[model samples]
Structure formats: C-alpha cells, structure tokens
Target chain A: SQTIHQWPATLVQPVGSPLSLECTVEGTSNPNLYWYRQAAGRGLQLLFYSVGIGQISSEVPQNLSASRPQDRQFILSSKKLLLSDSGFYLCAWSVKRGQPQHFGDGTRLSIL
Target chain B: AQSVTQLDSHISVSEGTPVLLRCNYSSSYSPSLFWYVQHPNKGLQLLLKYTSAATLVKGINGFEAEFKKSETSFHLTKPSAHMSDAAEYFCVVSPIYNDMRFGAGTRLTVKP
Candidate 1:
C-alpha cells in the first residue's frame, strides 16, 4: 500500500524566517507530488506540483516554492516567510492524472 | 479547465439521520470527480471517485455519491450519519493531466 509522510506536524515561525517542509511517499514510484495550503475554515489552494525531478509548476504565485529531488521525495520551501504564509500545509501524491490523490498528515504553520 | 463547487459551507445532522452534502463541478472534457473527507487537523482521505464508470459510486465508511452529468453535480450521501463522520468534505475535479481543482470544503457536523 502507498503512504505519504510529512514532517514537523506543527511549526511556529517568526516573520522573515526560512521555511522547509518535506514530503515522501512509500511503496510508490514516479508519483506526481503536490503542495497545497488551506486557510482556516477555507478551501485548499494549490501552491505547486511536480511531475518529475527538478520539474515544478506553480498554480498560485506566492512566497513559497517546491522541488522534487528524488522520485518520491518532494520539498516545499520558502526563502523568507511572510505573515500571509501562515496556514495548513498539505502534501499529496497521485499515481496518475485524473486519479484520486493520497495526502499526508498536514503541517500547521503559524507565522508570527 | 476543471473546477468544483461544494454548495454547503456547513451542515448539521443528527446521528442515524440521512446525510447529504451537495457538490457541483465544471469540466471541459470527460472529467474525473472525487470526494474526500478530512478529520480535524488531519490528512484528507478519499471517500469515492467517479471516472466515467457507474454513476453511483460507493466509498469507505458506508458513504456513496451519484454523478449526475446532466446536472453537473456529484452529491455525497449516506443512509445514516455517524458521530465519526463529522469532518470536512471536499469535491474535486480533474480534466486531463495535472489540472486538478478542489472545491471549498463543506464541514459536516454529526450531532449526538
């Protein structure tokens, strides 16, 4: 069975600090990875998605970016965090396009 | 382009009562639709998906949804609501490739 894992389940960061969130998939290969942010009591906003290593597409322009270094390892990073960056960060993986995506336990980030 | 709309922002239902959460979608092609549930501060889990197969799709936890192409709707339903069913539900749509869109989630509250 395929599973996705994300780290630092919750984080409190100061403004202008750096941000890094990692996501990895187990029992899956060459899976498409995605980064999403959800505001409190709101819908998910797609931030970035990657098809393969070093390939990423940004859906909404933001202070964050995403990278795929390995086949199943994805990273979401920010050079300097903004207050608006505070939200619930979620990582997801899909075997194929138009298929259901599997999500990891999200990282609740609070920027002060 | 594909997009989903979850009509209800929140719904309250008594235990053992029928549950209904409405969703509508727009897609350019034969789209793939999905319903997902998210526990508080947890990852999103797939409830069901419709991909040009049967209009009625059954998912985990005794949940089901009907895909009505003419109405462009895919509403989730359950015969009896359970306390454990209290969560956020999302409607998703995908047209072809990495063009997945999510609806603003609907929060389901099952009262005892």
Candidate 2:
C-alpha cells in the first residue's frame, strides 16, 4: 500500500516569514508529486507538480514554489509568506499521469 | 486543455436518501476523470476514477459514478447517504494524467 505523509499538520506563521511544507511518499517509486491549495471559492488550485527529482512545474503563479529533492520527497517552500498564502495546503502523489492521486493529511497554514 | 465543473456549490440531503453530485467536464480529446471527497480541514480522498475502461466505476464507501461521454459528465452517486458522507467533493479532469484541473467543489451536507 502507498502512503503519503505531510506535516506539520497545522502551521501558524507570521507575515513575511519563511514557509516550508514537506511531503513524502512511501511504497512507490518515481511517483508524480503535486501541491495544491484549497481556498473558499477558488477551489483547489494546483501550485506545483514534479515529474522527477529537481523538476517542478508551476501551475499557478503565486507566492509559493515546490521542489522534488528526492524520488519520493517533495517540498513546498516560500521565502516570505503573505496573508493571501493562508490556506489548506495538500500534497498528493500518483503512480503516473493517468492514475488516481493519493493525498496526504495536508497542512493548514494560517498567516498571522 | 481540460476543465471540470461541479454543478452544485452545496447540497443538503437526508440520511438514507439517494445522493447525487453532478459533474461535467470539457476537453479537446478523451480525458481521465475522478471524484474525490474531503472532510473539513483534511486532504482529498480519491473516491473513484474513470480512465476510459468502464462507464460505471465503483469506489470505496459504497460510492459510484457513471461516465457519460455523450453528456461529457461524470456524476457521482450513492445509493444511501450517510452522516459520514457529508464533506466537500471535487471533480477533476486530466487530459494527460499529469495535467490536472479541479472543479469548484460541491459541499455535501447530510442531515439527520
């Protein structure tokens, strides 16, 4: 069985502070990784996706960026956070392009 | 390009009643579709996916969806609604599996 893990589960960050959310997948190799933001009306916005290590694609231009440091380890980071950056951030992994994605518990980030 | 649309922003249903969440998609060619559920402040869970095999796909928790090519729709339905079924549901479309587009999401509320 494949499992995706994300942390810190919940986060409270001050404005202009740095942000880093980690997501790792187990029981799979060379999986596609994705980062999404869930907002009230905007729905689930795809922020970034990676096909392999050191490869990331930005779906929406925003204050966030993503990185695939390892085969199964993805990281979402920001040098400086903004108030608009507050939302539920979810990480997902899929075996390939046509497969259903498995998601992690997500990190609820609140910008103070 | 591909996109998804969830018909209802919110729906209220009584327990044990039939549940239907409408979803429609647009794409240039054959695309993959998926239905996902998310609890409050939680990550999205894959309920089912349509990858061109079967028209009717069954998923976990007694949930299922039918893919209608003539209608360009992939609507999710449950025989009986449960209290646990109350959550946010998303319809996703992928032209190449890696290109994911999410809907605005339909929030299902099951009343006692």
Candidate 3:
C-alpha cells in the first residue's frame, strides 16, 4: 500500500517569514504529485503539480513555489509568507494523470 | 475548460434520514468525475469516482453517487445519514490529464 507523509501538521508563523512544507510518498515511484491549498469556507485551489523530477506546472500565480527533488519527494516553499497564505495545505499523489489522487493529512498554516 | 458545481453550500440532515448532495459539471469531452470528503482540518478522502464504465458507483462508508450524462450531474446519496458523515464534500471534474477542477464544496451537517 502507498502512503503519503507530510511534516509539521500545524504551523504558526509571523508575516514575512519563510515557509517550507515537505511531502513524500512511499511504495510508489514516478507518481504525479500535486500541491493544493484550502481556505476557510472555500474549495481547494491547485497551486502546483509535477510530472517528474524538476518539472513543475503552476496553476495559480502566487508567492508559493514547488519543487520535485526526487521521484517521490515534493516540497512547497515560499520566501515570504503573507496573511493571505494562511490555509490548510495538502499534498497528493496519483499513479497517473487523470487518476484518483491520494492525499496526506495536510498542514494547517497560520500566519500572523 | 472543465468546471464543477456543488448545488448546496451547506446541507443539514437528521440522523437516519436520506442524504443527497447534488453536483453538476461542464466539460468539453467525456469527463471523469469524483467525490471527495474532508473532515475538519483533515486531508481529502475519495468517496467515489465515475469513469465511462459505471453510471452508478459505490464508495466507502455506505456512500454512492450516480452519474447522468444527459443532466451533466453526479449526485451523491446515502440511504441513512450517520453522525460520522458530517463533513465537507467536493465534486471534481477532470476532462484530461493534469487538468482537474473542483467545486466550492458542500458541507454536510448530520444532526443527532
């Protein structure tokens, strides 16, 4: 069975602070990875997706960026955090494109 | 372009009553539809998915959804609501690979 792990299940940061969230999948290789943000009372917004290492497609223009360092390791980063950046961030992986994605527990980020 | 619409932003149902969460989608081609459930501050768990194979799909936790091509709708239903079923549900549409759209989500509130 495949499992996704996300670190820092909850985070609190001050404005202008750096942000880093990591996601890793076990038991699968060369899977599609995705980053999503869910604001309060809103649906999830896809921030970025990667098909392979060093290949990322951004869906929204924002302060956040994503990187795929390894076949199953993905990272979401920001040089500076904004108040609007506070939300629940999720990491998901799928065996192939157009397939059902499996998600991690998510990171709740609170910016002050 | 592909889009998904969840009919109700919030739905309240008494325990033991039937549950219905309506969803509509728009796609240029034959689309893949999915329903995901999220608990408070948790990751998304896929409830069901509809490919071209089955119009009626059964999912985990006694949940089921019907896909109607003529109506462009994929509506989720359950015979009896349970307290554990109270959560947010999202409808998703994928027209092609790497192109997935999510609905605003419908919050299901099950009352004891």
Candidate 4:
C-alpha cells in the first residue's frame, strides 16, 4: 500500500513572504510526482511534475518552483509569494504514464 | 495535445435518483480517460478509468463510467444518488503518456 504525506494542511502567509510545501510518498519508489493548485470555484492547475529525482518539469510558469530532492520527496518553494499564489495545493503520485494518480490531502494556502 | 471538457459546470439531482455527468475529450491518439471525485476539503480520489480494455468501468462508492470512443466522451453514471455523493467530479484524459489533463470539473449536488 502506498500513501502520500503533505505537510501544513493549512497555511497563512503574508504577501511577499516565502513559501515551502513538502510532499513525500511511502511504500512506492520512482513514482511520478506532480504539484497542482486549485483556486476557489476552479479546477486543478498543474504547476510542476517530476519523473525522477533532480528532474522537474514546470507546466505553468509562475512564481512557484518545485524540486525533487529524493526519489519520493518533492518540495514546492517560492522565494516570495504573491497574492494570487494563495490556493489549495495538491501533491500527487502516479506509477507510470496514463495511470491513475494518487493524491495527498492538499494544503490550503492563504496569502494576506 | 490532450484535453477534456465536462459538459455541465454544476448538476443538481434528487436523492435516490439516477446521476449522470457528461464529459468529452480530444486527442490525436487513443486516449486514457478517468473520473475523479473530490469531497469537500479533501483530496481527489480515483473513481474509475478507461484504458481501451473496457468501455464500462465501475469504481468505488457505487460509481461507474462508460467510454464512447465514437463520441469521444466518458460519462459517469450511478444508479442512485446519496447525500454523501455530493461533491466535485473531474474528467481527465491522457494520450498514452503521462501528460494528463483535467477538465474544469462538474459539481454534483444531491437534493433531498
């Protein structure tokens, strides 16, 4: 059985502050990791995805950046956050291409 | 390029009635389709998937979806609706690769 863990289920950050969200998977190795953001009354938006460690792909360019430090560890970071950065951030993992993805509980970030 | 479109932005149905959420997809090749459910304030959960093997796929929580290649649609269906079933549903498509795309999502409301 595999499980994904995301830290800081809810976060409140001030404008221009830094942001870091962590995601780690257990019981699975070399899985594809993804980062998504969902705004209020909107759908999930892909931000980044990683097929392996140290290899990251940015889907939508913005202030956020993602890094895969380990085989099953992914982190989303930003040096300075913008007001539009506040949203529900989700971390997901998939076994291979065209497979179903497993998602974490997600982190609700509020920037004020 | 792969994309998905959910026909309805929001659907309201009475409890114990049949439920249907329409979805259409576009892809140059054979596409892999999926239905995902997200409860309020929770992570997205895989409901079902169609990988060209079976046109009708059954998923958890008594949900099912049928894939129509000619129509390029994958519509979710359930025999009966429950109050607990009220949530947001997303239609996803991937063209034999890991580049998964999600629709805007359709919010289901179960009325008593």
Candidate 5:
C-alpha cells in the first residue's frame, strides 16, 4: 500500500517569512507528485507538479514553487509569504499520469 | 485541454435522503474523471474515478457515480445521506498525463 506524508499538520507564519512544506511517498517508485492549495470557499488550485527529480511544472503563476529532490520526496517552498498564501495545502501522489491520486493529510497554513 | 464543473457550490440534504452531486467535464480526448471528498481542514479523499471501463463506478462509503460520455457528466450519488457525508466534494478531469483540472468544489451538508 502506498502512503503519502505531509507536515507540519498546521502552520502559522508571519508576512514575509519563509515557507517550506515537505511531502514524501512510501511504497512506490517514480511516482508523480503534486502540490495544491485550497482557499476558503474555493476549490483546489494546482500549484505545481513533478514528473521526476529536478523536474517541476507550474500550473499557476504564484509566489510558491515546488521541487523534487528524490524519487519520492517533494518540497513546496516560498522565499517570502503573503497574506494571500494562507490556505490548506495538499500533497498528492500518483503511480502514473491520468491515474487516481492519493492525498496526504494537508497542512493548514495561516499567515498573519 | 480538460476542465471540470461541479453544478452546485453547496447542497443540503436530510439524512436518509438520496444524495446527488452533479459534475460535468470537457476534454479534447477521452478524459479521466474523479470525485474527491474533503472534511473540514483535512485533505481530499478519493471517492471514485471513471477510466472508460465501467459506466457505473462504485467507491468507498456507499458512494457511486455514473459516467455519461454523451452528457459529459460524472455525477456522484448515494442512496442515503449520512451526517459523515457532509463535506466538500471536488470534480476532477484529466485529458493527458500530468494535466489535471479541478472544479470549484461542491460542499455537501447532510442534516440530521
């Protein structure tokens, strides 16, 4: 069974602070990883996705960026956070393209 | 390109009543569709997925959805609503590998 892990379960950050959220998958190899953000009263917006190590595609232009350092390790980071960056961030993994994605327990980020 | 639309932003249903959450999608090619549920401040969980095999797909927790290519719809339903079913639901569409789109989620409220 594949499992995705994300942390910290919740985060509170000040404006202009740095942000880094990590995601890793177990029991799978070369999986596709994705980063998504869900705002209040809105659906999820894909921020980034990675096919392989050091390869990332940005779905929407935003202050956040993603990286894949290992085959199953993905990281979402920002140099400086904005108030608009506050949201529930999710990490997902899929065995292949166009397949069902498995999600991790999201990180609720609040910016003050 | 692929896009998804969830018919209603919010739906309220009484316990023991049938549940219907409508979803429609568009794609250049045969698309893959999925439904996911999100509890308050939690990550999205896969409810069901349509991959061109079965028209009617059964998922976890007594949830099911029928894929209608003629209507470009994949509507989710349950015979009886449970309070635990109250959550945000998302409709997703994918035309190709790594190109997934999400609908503005539908919030399901099951009343006792």
Candidate 6:
C-alpha cells in the first residue's frame, strides 16, 4: 500500500522565476523515482530518474533538474523558468526496473 | 534500446461497442510492455502489463491486451466502451536495465 504525494498541484509562475516541485512516496523503500512532463496534445517526456538517494539520471537534458535528497523524496527545480517549461509535471515511483510505475496526481504549471 | 509505437493518434467509438487500440514495439530482447490511461489533466493509471508471462493480460475497468511476439504488438481492447473510458492511452516498453520508452499515445473518444 504505497502512495505518492506531489505538492502545488497547480502553479502559475512568471517568466524567469524560480521553480520547485516536491514529490514523496510512502510505504516503499528504495524505489525508483521518475519525473515526466506532458505537453498539450502530446505524450510524456522523461526528464529525470533516480534509483536511490543522490543517484539521479537525466533522460532528456533540459532547463529542469531533479534531486533525490532522501530515500523516498524527489524534488524538481529550476533556477529560472521558461515558457516552454509550462506543462503537466508528473512524478512516478516503481519497485525496480522493468516494473510498473505508479503516478502521482501531477502538477499543472503555467508560466505567465 | 526499446521503442513503442501507438498506431492511432485518436479513435472514436460508440458506447457499448468493442474498442481496440493498436501498439507496436521494438527491442533487442524480450521487453516489458504496459498500457496506461490518463484522463484530461490527470496522472497516468496503469491498465496492464506484459512481462513474458501471460500472453493475454487483463486490467482494470474491463480492459485487456494481448501480447504478440512475432508481430511485436500489444493491442488493447475492451468488450464494451463506456463514456467514462474516454481518455488518452499510452503504450510503454521497458527494456532490461534501461529507461522506459513511451509511445505517442492514442486518444480514445467514446461517443454516446
């Protein structure tokens, strides 16, 4: 019985502003964490993934970066936001590689 | 490396009718496949997965998919479509020790 929590479900930020989104999972230990973005009318794009604390992998290099400071805590942050950064951001967790991932409710970020 | 292709970008089906969404994948070895559904502005929900076990996998909401090795296909189907079933569907392929590859996604529209 694991659940993921994502904060700031809806965010509106001005251009060049900083951004920070948090995601944490409960009832799971040492799970793989992932960050994904979904643009309007498009599929998801993997931004980053972490197998363990302080072990982050970038799937698609972009303005966004992710950090796994704790075993079940992941944070996505950006020093300055761009217009292209506006999208539905999702955080997912999986028991391990080649396993099904459970997704959080996601955060709708709109850059003004 | 693993790649997934969702055959149709959008599909319209009448209520109570059979529903079908086609998907194809490419991988060097036996890959893990999954189907997920997402409502508008919502996170993904795992429908089913194929991990070289059962050829036919049943998922929630009365949806199921069959894995075809020769064709490298995993097509999703439902006996009867419901209005609530209208959403976007995704096909994903996860190779061993690699990041998961997602398809372009196929949007299923259920008409009354």
TM values, all candidates: 0.97, 0.96, 0.98, 0.98, 0.96, 0.98
Tens digits of per-residue lDDT for model 1, A1-112 = 9989999999999999999999999998899899999999998988998888899999888788888989999999999999999999999999877668899999999999
Task: Give the root-mean-square deviation of each candidate in angstroms.
Answer: 1.0, 1.2, 0.8, 0.8, 1.1, 0.8
| Cα displacement (Å) at residue B58, model 6 | 0.8
Which clashing pairs does model 5 show? none
Residues A3-109, candidate 5: write the lDDT tens digits: 89999999999999999999999999999999999888888888998889999999899889899989999999999999999999999998777888889999999
Show where candidate 4 strays beyond 4 Å: none
* Candidate 6, chain B, TM-score (2 decimals): 0.98
Binned by DockQ into CAPRI classes (incorrect, acceptable, medium, high), candidate 5 is medium
Alpha carbon deviation, residue A72, candidate 3 (Å)? 0.6
Give every collision pair in model 6.
none
Cα TM-score of candidate 6 = 0.98
Which regions of candidate 1 deviate over 4 angstroms?
none
lDDT of 6 by residue, A1-112 (tens): 9999998899999999999999999998999999999999999999999999999999887888899999999999999999999999999999997788899999999999
Local error of candidate 4 at A26, Å?
A: 0.3
Q: Which window of 10 residues has the lowest lDDT sum in candidate 3 chain A?
A: A93-102
Question: Whole-model lDDT for model 5 versus the true structure?
Answer: 0.91
The lDDT values for all models are: 0.92, 0.91, 0.94, 0.94, 0.91, 0.95
Model 2 residue A36 CA deviation in Å? 0.8
Going through the candidates in order, what is chain B's TM-score? Answer: 0.97, 0.97, 0.97, 0.96, 0.97, 0.98
Give the DockQ-based CAPRI class for model 1: high
Worst 10 residues of 5 chain B by lDDT: B93-102
lDDT of 4 by residue, A10-108 (tens): 999999999999999999989999999999999999999999999999989899999998999999999999999999999999997678899999999
